[model samples]
Target: MAAKLIEGDPQRLGDYRLAGRLGAGRRGVVYEAYDSGGRRVAVKVPHGDSELWRPLAGEVAAIRAAAPYCTARVIDADCAGARPYVVSEYVAGPSLRGAGRTLAGPDLLHLAAALATALTALHEAGIVHRDLTPDNVLLGPDGPRVVGFGPVSPTETTLTWPRLAMSAPAYTAPEAFTGREYGPAADVFAWGAVVFHAATGREAFEGSSLGTVMHRVLSVDPDLGPIPQPLRALVADALAKDPERRPTARDLLRDLVHADATVRLGAPCLAPDCLTHASPAACLPAACLAPSGGEAPRWAQEWTAERLTAEEVLGRRVCLADALLVARAPLTLDFLLAAGGAMAARLRTPCDDPGLGTVAEDAYVTLDPADRPFAPAMFLRLADGRGGPRGTRGTEERIAEAFGPLVVRAGDLARLADPALPYAWPRLAGWIEADRDARARLARDRLFWLALTTLLTLALVVALATRGGPV
Candidate 1:
């Protein structure tokens, strides 16, 4: 069999059954796997007997270690094996290089903003992604994630650095050619070059070959034609002839994200590229499929240029089904699913809900085993309280008090039916802004509930099997 075919084959790696291949390059191939826990995980098995797999130990470690720094989160890693592999959050989307010429105006601006945020996070971690080209940056549902780290620098550099790492003609800073220990500053320079390409469909650095591009990058001024005012200054700063003159990634991102108190803490609202997916755990990263009020392509066009943004497809809809169905992460729907029959004797108004607006107990519904909370239960008590003879019924208020912490407060309830709830949600997020820690506590409580439900289900099966009476 051809080497590519052999490496790319979908098969078992240990006990995990591989579904299919995702992507592969010099490092190794990644396959979809179902773990013992039955969670959908992307498993990367390293190439055996290759020098590339050696340094990959550090690469894998650094990736998991710096998970918070970028959108490409590492869920697990096995570098101790002869062939090191890393399992991470599978963010599905196109690389910036492949994003095509379709993006312009706001879509383009949002992409820049996401890139700036990711770059800022990476720099803060003190790890410089030596290869910051468009091909290495992916547009995930939540935001941009930097990838392709063959030339990633460690806390200290040694011999394995490639010639390409020495300097890219377009993105190479002045000091890079002269051999200075590159740092976050190098990445800043690359961002300018990458953004230039993103803004206008042109490689900022055009040269006859590798040699020409390098010479010109060192000598020429960057072409900033028709660059909008918002990012023009940032691009110029990154492309500064003097490395010291450039601003840090965070500083640059702050300016680009329009860092108001509201915009910074909440999810960024720039471009579709900033949106990885409506459900961060399931599906690949992207704007919604059809985008709000947009058209979807016929099945045939998927082969060509009809890839819809997640927002375009979902049209501002957020579905928790995929992530909830699988034990993906914190967002599982098992608890929400249990809410249908969840009978909270006291309903533990336990510190989880943030939407309380002097409402009673019935207003907030308990979460199901899948951890999904229903809006109807969250607001029913509001109506009950208003119609009652007093502020709230005595029993309802007490139930509300017990579950007060757990109940989704009425003030927190907005029209769950709102089309824009996923895309343009209110400033007071359902997750944040609560006086109590309902979201977290509910997640914890729901695990117990799901276990109980599973036990109940198994017990019922056992009773049926052992029954003496014939039907």
Candidate 2:
């Protein structure tokens, strides 16, 4: 992947000389570099202002924490100058996505387990990867090594803003998008997405639209494609909408390790070198051990906005908006569909409240796209105005017809939906309204303080002049 450094590429990042371009993304440019001692490493230089470089300290700490478990150790970092840079051990391998080779069977299991182990280390240190996708994983000669983990601002939206460039909407956890309390469980959810992609040779819930991707992550089950047996079930559990229900990274590592052990114990090596004893690497073929050693066919691809197709550009925009909008729209027609179907079944038998229908009816208008924020702008472009009725009545009726006759259990209903389904809409509205109010209050407070300070300063000056002191 080495190429001559072109114009705009920094000649030196700290003491390392930028030799060739490793990769470039929205956030930063990665360079294949060598240090003063002639040791090879990767240097990532942020492209924007001081605000973008502020998160580097936290990112560096997280990377250092993850070093013990398949993460490249941070070698150096400098934030003193106008441009900030971080140098980490350069892993010479293709990313899991660009490996250009199929990863399934035992190889896939190994990679998944390694990633889980890495995440376990990271989570134990109280750092969420936030953005863990196939592109971030480097399959080195040893195993899968996670590289990118610095300065991804959850609120940054600009593509030129290097602080938050690694946004993968499909791989993002449901709680993350909803602005709910997300923790290590969110990283586990992304782990499932990565495993799905590796097993199926395709994105788990990829679509032509960001709305489509969001809906799938939030409401629809992932198309696991032809993933076989136990692994499919494991992936499904990881993709569970309820964060608590998803297994811990340690739990995943153990399960994968156990599964791998079971297979090894059951099969005896047929190698003629020795029947006495053998390690997994000693017996397995070199091809099986190095599943990621391959070449990308499109090696000469350049990073440019003009090269991006319309669909690709839109997807990027959606990702950027998703990252920026902390308080998203409260309701979606899809959310109403699932909740309405459950509500209808409950109405059949009398509960404490017979007027539940009225309550549901009252909340319907909020489901309209006009009330929503982040996603509506992007989705509206895809929908024509002449679709149908604007309110939730029409949508509820459609959902009721689809699920009312069937025996739908609450567990089944909540599986594809977020566990905070009941409070999501109301809480979403509350967060958005509260944020607006807080901003207004802060603005007023600033002005009031400014006026008070000015008055106090003038009074002091008058008093000093009357006392014959230097004014």
Choose the strongest candidate by TM-score.
2
lDDT per residue (tens digit) for residues 1-471 in model 1: 011224536455554545456566434566555444444456666544544455555655555555253346667765555445566655556677776753455455556655555565555555676657787776654455666542232323432333543434566665676676677787788888888987787777788786677766777886786677657877889888678999887666555433221132233333322223343322422342445455643331341243443223323222212212122223112222121111111111122212112122233334232322323233333323332212334434444344443333353232222111111122213323342377578888999999999999998888877895432
Write the residue-wise lDDT of candidate 2 on 1-471 in tens digits.
Answer: 545567887777667667667787655778777665545678888666856566557666666655365677778887656778888887767788877665767667667766776776677676777668898988776567776766555344322212221258778788766766666898899999998887877877778877777778889897775676557778889999989899987667645543543455444323433211222234433433334555421311221213443234334532211111111222222222222222112212112321112233344434545433432221221122222222453443343233232112242121101111122234333454565688799999999999999999999999999999998
Superposed by TM-score, candidate 2 places the C-alpha of residue 204 at a distance from the truth, in angstroms, of 0.5
What stretches of model 2 exceed 4 Å from their correct place?
A: 51-59, 151-166, 267-471
Clashes per model (N, Cα, C within 3 A):
62, 1
The per-model lDDT (C-alpha) reads 0.50, 0.57
Error of 2 at 275 (Å): 27
Candidate 2's TM-score reads 0.52
**Where does candidate 1 have its weakest 10-residue lDDT segment?**
339-348
